[model samples]
Target: MIISRESGFRHDTKRRGQSMPKRHPVNQTHNALEDEDSCAVYTALLADQGSTRSELRTKARLPLPVFTAAMEQLHRLGLVERDPSADERLLALPPATAMIRTCGDDLRYLAEKQERVYRVTASLSPYSRVYREMPSSGGITASGKRLLNRAEVGETLRDLTAGARGEILTSLPTGESEELFTLTENALRRGVRLRALYRSSVQFNQSSARDTQRLIRLGAEVRLVEDGFTEIVVIDRSAAVLPLRDDAEGALVVQDPHVVHFIVNAYSRAWAEGSAFPVRYRRQQVLEASDRTKHVIMKLLAEGAEVPTIAKRLAISPRTCQRHISEIMNRLGARNRFHAGYLVGQRGLVD
Candidate 1:
């Protein structure tokens, strides 16, 4: 059948012959047929078609009995078939489906074992413990257990102010009185770095202008931004306090690091993007003079004062009064008296 010599079929058959014992023909025959060498020879011979028994024996270099034993094993293993098309003298290879089926079974067994191991590991993980103990509510209360009153909150703030070596971030809005202003000034006089943000509209008032100037001289930074809410105060990076209500009675003292860090970041972003309060104050002061003059001229014009009457009342010439009215219309960006009054009201220039 043109079987290659390198297949080791011939050597295996010969080894079985040399190991056989005499006077035990039946036992020797069964043992030789069941041996590993016999199985190797059987597998090799099945791979070679059209091979005669004599030819197989000659190639395998084995005696008749050993060769017959190997051929019988090949028949038992179902690796060879008697080829009826060739006078039943030759052996044929088994179909490839059997070998592939065995390999697929082994792969499926390994995959099942791996899945079982993964399921067991996941069930025993530490995250499973956390999941079992979730939704807990026995920690600190909203009003802290240690500090229960305003007096305690004040003491804590005083300690924070004393320990504040660098800078402070605060938003102080003037309301019924200037209590916050006094507290801010006290901090400023202590040489503590202060960065303050106030509402833009009130920032130009006479009292606010003087207070802002004092803060600037004390090395405090100030800005004005569009206001929506009350105030936010962050002292150093260690602590933060926000009023729980708009009336500024009770405060929420934040000691959690993550929450305080987020508050500080929000304040820093607002400060950087905000307008300069001092510059807005200066512009308002400069514009007030022209605004007052425009108001006087508008009143006289409404009262039907002649040009000479207006000039005498304003202590200016008739031509100068007319020029002033023209300048006021241009400055107000108004087309008529109604539009001028609207613009003035919109600008919040009137008392």
Candidate 2:
């Protein structure tokens, strides 16, 4: 006769069957094996019991052959019995109520220990050695992260320009824009040195009479260059603002010293070769001499006259000379003065 207890079974036979189930080696070994197999099957079932074969394949992250072999092994061991009432591929397990009850105290102990460890580690995190020595590169600094909205942008700019003692280098596509002029003037009044590069068109457009006059009166050093470079503003060789969006609504502020140095170097090179913004226009200008002012400008440019010198010889202000040159290149759809000259020569305008 076999009598069941809460923890184990008691058996009585004609022989000396007085031993407890816990002391029976054969029964203990079998129970241990079943427990081990049950744990594995339970975990897998919990992960994907109600899922389809395709879902199981994805969740298991195993190859098809390996997944099939695992399922077959589980079925043969009786750990996963088939669910005949449902789909043929579906399987189920007998309720593990008794086994789970036996391990409840041990599982609870482990869970409590894990929670304690997590709390202690989190409490000590700020003092960690790795965080203390964190390296700095190009990403946002702590201060920048705190100032993220439009309202704070002005404060950020003020802080950036506060102690800027060196020259600020900038390039403007539309130098005549009023906002840009105001910003430049503010920087100048703050005693910050200014070096600006403007597109050739802004130099000569008589339509922007007041803007040109104001720029000249401010005595802000200016230059005219022909290129597709967008607006670039570098402050004191330490920071730069480069527009990320087409309309200049978004910008990436670069605080990396190396990047700012590279940008400043490029700006200096362009400035060194660029013409200065002239104060006033003269009567006998190179631009006024020919009906095809663009062709004449390209011919002179190809002859290797510096932009400032060309402006002087042409009798117009240097800005006006640059504007004429820019127009010629655009009409010919040329990349630079040299290219414009080539196209003009092709048309027999210049030898």
Give the top-scoring candidate (TM-score): 2
Leading candidate by lDDT: 1
Tens digit of lDDT per residue, candidate 1, span 183-215?
A: 556777877778887655445357767777777
* Residue 193, candidate 1: alpha-carbon lDDT: 79
Q: Each candidate's lDDT (Cα)? A: 0.61, 0.60
lDDT by residue for model 2 over 13-66, one digit each (tens)? 333533322311112333554454445444666665665556655665666766
Superposed by TM-score, candidate 2 places the C-alpha of residue 256 at a distance from the truth, in angstroms, of: 0.6
lDDT of 1 at 213: 73
Task: Give each prediction's root-mean-square deviation over alpha carbons.
Answer: 26.0, 20.0
